[model samples]
Target: MSTFDTDLLIVGGGPGGLATALHARRLGLSVIVAEPREGPIDKACGEGLMPGGLAELTSLGVDPAGMPFHGIAYLDERRRAEARFRGGPGRGVRRTTLHAAMAARAKEQDTEWIRTRVNTVEQDAHGVTAAGVRAKWLVGADGLHSSVRRAVGIDVTAGTPRRYGVRRHFKVPAWSEFVEVYWSRWGEAYVTPVEPDLVGVAILSRGQPDLAWFPRLSRQLAGGERGPARGCGPLRQVVSRRVAGRVLLVGDAAGYEDALTGEGISLAVKQAGAAVTAIVEGAPESYEAAWHRVTRNYRLLTRGLVLASTPRPARRAIVPAGRLLPSAFRFGVNILAS
Candidate 1:
């Protein structure tokens, strides 16, 4: 009889979960993934993969087709500042497309799948059994409200300001080669071109999503074929720990600060690799330190920016500050992109 059903059992089938499956397969581990949803998963996201993130996904042999953007553009009524990445370009891929590509890659790697929700998680010193599968290890790649995180007693209460994000797609021709962020008194709007004739707009704020809050961006997106809007929120998530016995938390399930810097996918993929490495080496505890190292910059910089953006005077100065200090802005963008 097999000691365990598989080497790794992954909960949730989002991009992060699928990425974990691919990495585990690459390390010669038998894997099974459980996801409640069918078909490609979609979420309310900015959908722009930074250059480094695109490269990471490609290295894993999971590249999705989308529009290309050179860098980032910060725009406001008073000023506009743009910065191109030093090396390659970021791609504005739709969430569904990205998820499909990741799932296909996981399937190609011979990963098993279970189309069911993981309502309970049980683990001991040797292995974990979740969603009815017993494995040497369990990875929670679930989203912000991960059941596994809660079940394992690692979930933490978010201490930062609560904010939400709502996104919609518009049918419009590509006008620029940059991911543009338009600022207003209310919140920030991210415009990314996912297809030649499709642009995704996501607004982040504390208040309810009302495009009317941003007059300029609303006017720009006026009268277009609007796709169904999706919302996700209270962007910040804290965690007491990442590893509990044989179970490890990855991606948003591990913890999250905010989406302001757009590093979620990249960080998730990177954390997936680290989580699998620790599992393969028989040192699940090491993943906690690795997670901190990987997310240090994201946590600090994103928190600082979010704080700076809260005050009206400071928010108004954001664009002009970037414009006046191009080098500093470029450095910031490069750090986040990297």
Candidate 2:
């Protein structure tokens, strides 16, 4: 028999990994998380937590402080459309704030942490080892470019219409209760109210982002204290599979589409639950199907929207279509929300 340092060794200490730790602890499994960064790690994101996602975090005893948004609004120079969430209001939390809350909750649950980056992985029929820890199962919750995914031989390739996102905070009061998305020929700018006096703007585009794309939004943000910018890219990551032996992928490392729909964190949290459940069942490979089920709606809707918005004409029609077909818009929003 092989002795193990923990029941689960999770690489990356982001929301997904922490959530996995919390779930594992709840199920009486010892977990060790390896993350190179310190607490309150910030990332380039829209910062809007959908109602479903907020509920998931709450269930885990993590409630980050931020502004509450009732729905999502789509806008252009001439038109606008809004879709309210049916269940409850979502929160727009800063990435750092969310991370801190999750980390604290995981700590309270007795999840151990190792400050190291996992570059290589070694697993056998008995257990897996990485970052100097041995465990019965391994989970890769690392971001888009996951080394563990590669170390486990999971094939990944970049997808087309390669999109990138750049985000920063502005010291201005939020004007809308809805998370607003301003569209232009250049790209889309997502304005999420993360705090009463601060809003986060994330630009998504095929090329480098420029605020000139949305003149009105730029003007509205003029003179506000601008924080340092952060960026992430080629939003679409095509993964061949989610499971390799005893290792399972979660969060962005599992797979990714585009951030246009704003449900990344929610999906990550949900996936963490599924991953932990698979591990607890002693059937790691079952997580692959579970992953597909969790991400099916997000994949279909987000991919279709991304494709539709790729063309300039279709991009221009999005808000108008939502305005004309309010029921369809609400249905789509509610589907992703659930």
Candidate 3:
């Protein structure tokens, strides 16, 4: 008989992994989270949580503080379009704030944490082992460049148009209640109001991100107290599957699409629940289909938007099109938000 340290050993203690730990504890499963980073982990992201994602986190008993935006806005030099989520408002919380809330909730539920990084994984018919611990099941919730995914031999490749994102915070009062996405010839800049006096700007593009690409936005942020810039990507990660024997992958480790639609965190939290569900049911393979169901809308919509925005003409047309077709824009936004 094999000895187990916990029922579930999660590699990575970011939002997704911590969420998985929380879910596992709710179902009476012992969980151990291995993460090298300390609390309040921060990352480069748009920092806007859709209503659907907020609901998921609320259900998990985590309520992070942040500015609440009722809708999304797309803007260009002259045109602007807005879409309010039909369901409710989404919060624009800093990455660190969100992480801290989830981590605290997980700890309150008595989830164990270990300080270590997992470089390799070993699994057998009975269980899986990594980072000097053994568990009946394992999950990889690590980010874009996941050592756990690679260690488990999950096939992954970079998607086309190879995009990347960089984000920085400025100590300027948010100018709008909506999460504003500025469209430019070079790329898009996402301005999210994370706090009353703070806004996060994330740039996504095919090449290196530069705020100068949007002259108006650059001028608006010219003299604010700017925080250090953080970056991530080649945005799209194409993974072959989400299940490997006793191991499962969630969040970016499972697979990823471009962050053009700003649904990454919400989708990740949903995936965590699905992962824990499959584990509780003793059907790890079910997680693949569950993951598919949870992420289908995000993948399709985000991928479609990424492809449409690849060309200069289509990119320029986006804001105008949103203005021209307000109903369509609102419908699309609400679908993702739901």
Candidate 4:
């Protein structure tokens, strides 16, 4: 048998990567994590942690502070509908705050971190290696464009009408208890309250992000202190598979559809636990099926909604549909919440 430097080597240092490190440690595996960026890392996101995701993080002993939201609200020029999560409220935490909390938790669990990016991934029967570290198993928790996924020949090409997200913070008083999704002619604007006086506005659209496109949101945010805008995506990535040999992929690195549903963080955390379970059981193949189970709801619902909203007329019907079918809409919200 070959010797290994660590029980597991994790690529990427974002939330998924750090969460994997913490979970692996809980399973008695020694882990080394490689990440190029320093904390607390910020990304363009809606910043809303769904109730299910919040519980997952709390269960992992990571409870970050932020504003609480009762549920999700859909609004348009003519219609509006809101539903509260039956279980609990999701929190709107800043990306940096989330990163700091998760990173601290990982460090406290004794997971070692290397400040470097993973450029290559090599594997064999006995072990896998990346970023110069050899381990019994390797996990790719890197983001949308994961090098490990590419190295393993599982990276999927993104197809269009590829949606993109741009998020900016405004120093304005939050006016609602629900995470508001404002639908306009061009795209959707997600307003999440991260603090008592700060709201983050994230736009998801195929067209270029112009505030003029969301006239209502633009006016509401007028006169507020604007923070630098951060952007991400063409918002769709497909993976041929989640596992190859002794290496596995987790979080966004595994596969992604869109951020329209606001389930990213929670789903990633759950996938981390599943990935570690498969690693601990010495069954990489099992991770693929487990990944499917973990992401099934997200993939199906997000993809279906994206498809439904692709056409102009259908896009206009979303808010009104929710308003007309409150029960059905609430069921959808509760399903994702739990």
Q: Which candidate is the best by lDDT?
A: 2
Clash numbers, per candidate: 0, 0, 0, 0
List, residue by residue over 1-338, the lDDT tens digit for candidate 1. Answer: 44799999999899889889988898899999999899999999999999888888998999899999998999987588999899789999999999999999999999999988886898777878887788989998889999998888885887568999999999978778999999988899999999998999999999887777667777777778999999997888888899999999999899889889887998999999999999999999999999999999889999999998898999999999999999999999999888
- In the range 1-338, model 4's lDDT, one tens digit per residue, is 78899999999888899889988998899999988887698989889999988988898889999999999999987678999889979999999999999999998999998989887888999999888888999999989989999898885989667999999999999988999999876889999999999999999999788877767677889899999999999789878999989989998899889998999999999999999999898888988899899888888898998888989899889999999999999999888888
Residue 185, model 4: Cα distance from true site in angstroms: 2.0
Off by over 4 Å in 1: none
lDDT of each: 0.90, 0.93, 0.93, 0.90
Off by over 4 Å in 3: none
RMSD values, in order shown: 1.1, 0.7, 0.8, 1.0
Q: Which has the higher TM-score value, candidate number 3 or candidate number 4?
A: 3
TM-score of each: 0.98, 0.99, 0.98, 0.98
- Native RMSD of candidate 2 (Å): 0.7
Residue ranges of candidate 2 with Cα displaced over 4 Å? none
The residue-by-residue lDDT of candidate 3 on 120-238, one tens digit each, is: 99999999999889999999999888998899888999999899999999999888889999999889999999999999999999888888888878888878999999999998999
Sliding window of 10 residues with minimal summed lDDT for model 3: 213-222
For model 4, the stretches where C-alpha displacement exceeds 4 angstroms are: none
